[model samples]
Target: MDKERLPRWGWLLAGLFVAALVANLLNLFVLVPTVFPEEYRAVTVITTMSPVLIYVGVWYDEHRQHYWEQSGAHIAGDVLFVVTGAALGSAIVLVAIIDFGIPAFLREVLAMGAGFLMSWGLFWWRNPDVYADESAR
Candidate 1:
């Protein structure tokens, strides 16, 4: 019999790493010099969309149907929407900081990072049991 490739929680950690890496790469290469001011749209879009796309590769193993049957997609979607709220909240604070003379690029980066961390942390905090191993199902 085939075994589960990774512990359930591993998937989330992997997704987080991938999302962060991709965002950083975009910042270092494509997003920084774009016409948009300080990469604002790039940062916000990455922060908001990562959750929805996090599981793209995990569906390949048909034998592990139980693992894929969780409400993870729904939960991921919930986390995705919270991203908008987080970004908006961070923007309000960033706006106030702007009056204090912070660099726009730095401010945008901070906002995106904070928003993503909040969403990721919230996902983990509220869903402790969501990633229980297949054996626990």
Candidate 2:
């Protein structure tokens, strides 16, 4: 198989990593939350959906095409992206916990959600072609 046709998980991972880094830096320097605190749960829901979305897209792609195509790569990329987001998020959370004390439960959840979303959004942006193709099917 031509390697160019393969799904580029590395791009997704890199994009997510960059996004997390930027968002966190913005949050830290600006002293403001990047995502709406009230929508934290919603953010979590969206971020959590990344793997499931990639899996379904891959499963369908493989079944339809008789070969795993972009889906598998997409899933792998998303995993790396998620890990990056989680690690970066954990660091931010630790800082918040140490400096401001534990936030209210909802706020804590939202902060994490924001981190996840930051990564997920980057993945979506970097892999627009795959996402667009998956949606068209």
**Taking the tens digit of each residue's C-alpha lDDT, what string does model 1 give over 1-137?**
22277754655566666766776666667666674356255454556444634233234344434444668776566566556545655556565566666777777667766665665556555554444566776
Instruction: Go through the candidates in order and give the clash count of each.
Output: 0, 0
TM-score of each: 0.45, 0.40
Q: Which candidate wins on TM-score?
A: 1
User: What lDDT does each candidate get?
Assistant: 0.56, 0.50
| Model 2 C-alpha lDDT per residue in residues 1-137, reported as the tens digit of each score | 33244355644454445555654555555434544443233233334434443433444354434334557776577677865664456346544554465455655565556555656566566555544655576
Name model 2 segments beyond 4 Å from true.
1-68, 71-74, 102-104, 131-137
